[model samples]
Target: MDDCIIIGAGPAGLTAAIYLTRFHLSIRLFDCGSSRAALIPCTHNHAGYPAGVAGTELLRLMLEQAEKYGATREQAEVTAIVPVAGGFDVQIGDRTAKARTVLLATGVVNNRPDMDPAEHDAALQRGLLRYCPICDGYEVTDKRVGVIGTGDHGMREAIFLRGFTPDITLIAPGAAHELDDACRAKLDEAGIVHVDGPCTPIRIAGDRIAVETPAGPLTFDSIYPALGSVIRSKLAVAAGANASQDGCLEVDEHQRTSIPGLFAAGDVVKGLDQISHAMGEAGVAATTIRNLLAEQRPIRR
Candidate 1:
């Protein structure tokens, strides 16, 4: 039985693995390899990378460092996490592994419009489709931007993006911007342009994103989708952990869920969706896990 089982291989999971291994705790890190971090082209917000680092490259380096410290990397999709007598049974398909503690870092999946697979992949590679503004909104300061979504979330994003530029456009839903009078007034006060209709046929070409609407072709230097996300916390819930409506686990101070012997960190846990924050939370969780295990280990004379 491994001392800890880490689900997901993103920054949080990798950091936890590194910490656990350094403490001589047996760890098995499992990842399905569909991390949102892998989709980012560059993240200038992270430390040490002045020019920013490709998400894939950062993940690779983290994995290499984790392995160097004796963390066993298991490239398997965790199908189920069943609580057992002592700890828990981590299942991957027909296989089973034992762990005294589990750390869930399975991050959320950003909601995206249905598009051609190749086209979406190309957009992500080109950095045209962004999910987080706090990460790179500074880079596009003073540039025209389109905030896509219909609800208050979209309006809030448009208003938030306004901090960087006043030339912001809110892409509303349906054939009209169905915002209430209060919201419309809010947008006007913020000096943000509202496009009363859904954006369609979003295409990227040569450093610009063009959207087709009833009003005509609208173009922007960049686009931010505030469509929210689907946090992957089902495994935690299935294991008796409490999660929010958005599927984010409600972790305690030690990152421990309601279920004993199970902890969480990163996007899967209720917190900011930033890499730096994720790493910090994971570090705390790893230390807590180490202390918890120490209490359970046999006392040496």
Candidate 2:
């Protein structure tokens, strides 16, 4: 049994483990070693490193920092989480570890196009298609861009894209009338073009993305997929934690979920899903867990 068990080795989980280990808490981290952060080749927006750094390198440094604090890292997939008498049991492979607390930082997987590498390689390599506006929106200033996705998230991304580019199009795979009057009005006021119906196949050539739509084959400098993430919240949800419509866990300022002894951060929780935000949430969660554990200690007579 350990004081804490953190699932996922991404920024949020690693940061939480580092903080908890520094507090002299025994912590174990379970990870599948798949972080969306690896998709980024170079990141210039993250604070610190004036010259910027490679995403893989930054992740490596974070892992090193966590290990230096005595946090045990194991490569394993967490199949399930079961509540026990005093805490929780984490099922990994055939083994189960009981912990007083658990932090779920397992991030979401971005839904990407299933295009062949040779076809979409250039576009993917050049950042023509992006998933995170908070990370790459600034780079699209004054450029014609198209966002693919439907529903509230798509509408929200379209609004956010307006900050960087006026020539923006929100391509929904469904009927335009599916949006409420307020959202439609906002798009109209923003001068954003809305195209309904299925997205035409996207063809990447040189530096432009040629998307075939019912309107016509539209060419844009960039395409953003605002499709919601498939957040892994079943473990926490099964433990009686609340979640949003998109399946992201609901947490408080302390990053504690509705379930006692269970906490979550990063994309798994409702937020901007940025590295900085994730790290901040992890710090808060670590402090909260530490306090909870301290309070549980028996007082000597």
Candidate 3:
């Protein structure tokens, strides 16, 4: 059996693979090609990249680094992970790979707006549609921004973005706004415009994104969809691991999950959903895994 099997080849999984492989531990890295990080056009927040780095470029570099140290990678999705005798039986269709430990870096999927996929992609590439203001709020600084969401999640995102730009609009994804008294008070105090929605993306013109709202067609330099995400924790939860109500995996400081031989990192574990944070967690998890396995069996050159 391999020393470890890592699922999801994002920054977290790849980082772990690099560490474990450098420690001379055998590992198998699985990727389903749906890493949220891959969608990032360019991120300026990730340290050491002054001109900012494209997500794809970063992942490519990490994968290369991991491979340089003999980290085996498979471009296949792990459907199920069953805890077996000494480790886990990672299922990928008809084949199964066994390892002494399994690390999950399977990240979350963003819930996008109801726009046409082509249009959405175009707008996203053009920097007119965005998510995660924390990642790229600087790109939209002091520009008119529209936020398509409501309730606490919407309110919080709008308030956070307010620090970047003064012109902000919070529009409900449904027919009307769902703000309670406190939510309204907060928005009012923050000077955010609240509008009823069921909004649809009308068009994307030069440097502006247009959305059709009940109030009328609205245009903004950028639009942020505050809809939540679908956490990809089903594999771990199905394998009898404990998770929070929102489906985020519960991990201790060392990134150990409730299951002894199973571990997790990245967005699945819930914290700051940033690439740097995920990488840090992966580093800790990889070291812990090395120590734990050494306790069971000695490592030698």
- Candidate 3 differs from the real structure by a C-alpha RMSD in angstroms, to one decimal, of 0.8
lDDT of 1 by residue, 44-110 (tens): 9999999899999999999999999988777899999999988999999999999999999999998
lDDT of 3 by residue, 1-301 (tens): 9999999999999999999999999999999998988888899999999999999999999999999999878899889999988999999999999999999999999999999999898988878989889999998999999999999999999999999999999999999899999999999999999999889865697779999998899999999999999999999999999999999999999999999989999999989999999999999999999999999999877
Give lDDT per model, in order: 0.88, 0.85, 0.94
Off by over 4 Å in 2: 113-122, 174-177, 298-301
Q: For candidate 1, which ten residues in a row score worst on lDDT?
A: 113-122
Encode model 2's per-residue lDDT on 138-221: one tens digit a residue: 888999999887667778899999999999998875545367888888889999988985675887867788787777788899
How displaced is residue 296 in candidate 3, in Å? 0.3
Evaluate model 1: give its lDDT: 0.88
Give the local distance difference test score of model 3. 0.94
After superposing candidate 1 on the true structure, give the runs of residues whose Cα lies further than 4 Å from its correct spot.
298-301
Candidate 1 vs 3: which has more TM-score: 3
